[model samples]
Target: MNDQNNPRDAESDYADRIKLTVALLGKNNKASDVMLARQLGRNVLLEELGAIEEPYRALQPYEIDSNQRDNFAVHTREDIVMVYSLAVRANEQLYEIRSLVRILIALLFFLTVLFFISVIWR
Candidate 1:
């Protein structure tokens, strides 16, 4: 039975969305921009990206061997590009970057406070 709002299984739903990426990449898959546009809706795929395939994705029917690296989402913005990695080390890079940004912000805040104090003292 399907819930009216939820509709399909999350992973199964992701399969369709993931196809758009595969189609855009021209990864020898059973889809194209035109086809996806019809099935998914217009402008679903960014045609100008031109199949660079830099930000990795795992296609459906994932056939993994022992050597296969389990991927993780690394700060994806909607549909443009996403990063993934191994050792279940999926989102680590993005997390690390975010942590660094937080630290940098804290340091800047401290410096700003010091500067304000000096200005007030003068």
Candidate 2:
């Protein structure tokens, strides 16, 4: 199980959330498949994050040589975005592992309750 007291874990999901927000904010891409993918991907990411606050806020653009904003600008730092992407993926794996553990715990609880009921009925 992950340590819930960890502040670092709390901040890690923000990267994925920012990515989702960016895709939703993207106005340049009009392709239906791409749009649908972005929506579904965002949905899945949200589900995986499990009730995050401000899950869809767009990242602010940063300073540069040109005054005009880029067409598909996501975040100020590309390097940080990449790092966040890696964090999101790593979090996904952790979620999967925790999910499996929860399933096993649920099954065990069910069996224990059944055993108690059978004993009481006897």
Candidate 3:
């Protein structure tokens, strides 16, 4: 029988959620897969075993350069979630615009062909 008090058991229960959190953070931050993997590995070793807490810590400010430090924004999980959600919506909108442009181009081509045929027949 699995012991409920075991940290491994707790981690197992939240593994999917943790993976999802990491994936969303990676997408939002435009991180490479290898970078994301490394961060996830480090997080697993460093963080407490349970629910994924504050996955955006990787995005926190680092005092590497004064200019970079000035631009750093401290974000919470909710903030990251909002930013990711907005990005998804924007991407969907861009897809819709591209589809509409394709449809319009097709219609224009059909009209041009019809006009040319009519002029040639006359």
Candidate 4:
């Protein structure tokens, strides 16, 4: 029942990860620097110190609100900062994915056309 590889099992393991990240941000600590601090075994500072009460309430036990989770992921100081940085990285990655997909599709279409042309010529 306990598979370490699959986090999507019966128990919500990612919740702990998310909660840890949220706690870091709730304390007004910067999330982007959390990794460095974690690597150095040090503490990181979070951003917005004020707007945490709402998130805390949302994160209360038995509350499985995805919106709250998203809010925590986005609005929290550490989350917002980290997400913004991630968004920039995601956008760059997205551009690359889109370009790659376009190239692959074009090549496939060209190959298909060539196949049809050869068949007709034959």
Choose the strongest candidate by TM-score.
3
Candidate 2 wrong stretches, greater than 4 Å: 1-82
What is the alpha-carbon lDDT of model 3 when measured against the actual structure? Answer: 0.56
Pairs of residues at least 3 apart in sequence or in different chains that clash in candidate 4: 28-46, 28-47, 29-45, 29-46, 30-45, 30-46
Candidate 3 ranges beyond 4 A from true positions? 1-75
* lDDT (tens digit, per residue) of candidate 4 on 34-122: 64345222111111221122333322343436875676566557656887999899999999999999999999999999999999999
- Clashing residue pairs in all predictions, respectively, total 0, 0, 0, 6
lDDT of the candidates, in the order given? 0.46, 0.55, 0.56, 0.52
In candidate 1, position 116 carries an lDDT of: 100
TM-score of each: 0.31, 0.31, 0.40, 0.38
Which tens-of-lDDT digit does each residue in 11-65 have in candidate 3? 5434554576566765545464555556555554334322234334324543246
**Model 1 segments more than 4 A misplaced:** 1-90
Of models 2 and 4, which has the larger TM-score?
Answer: 4
Pairwise TM-score winner, candidates 2 and 3: 3
Error of 2 at 119 (Å): 1.9
Worst 10 residues of 4 by lDDT: 42-51
Q: Between prediction 3 and prediction 4, which has the larger lDDT?
A: 3
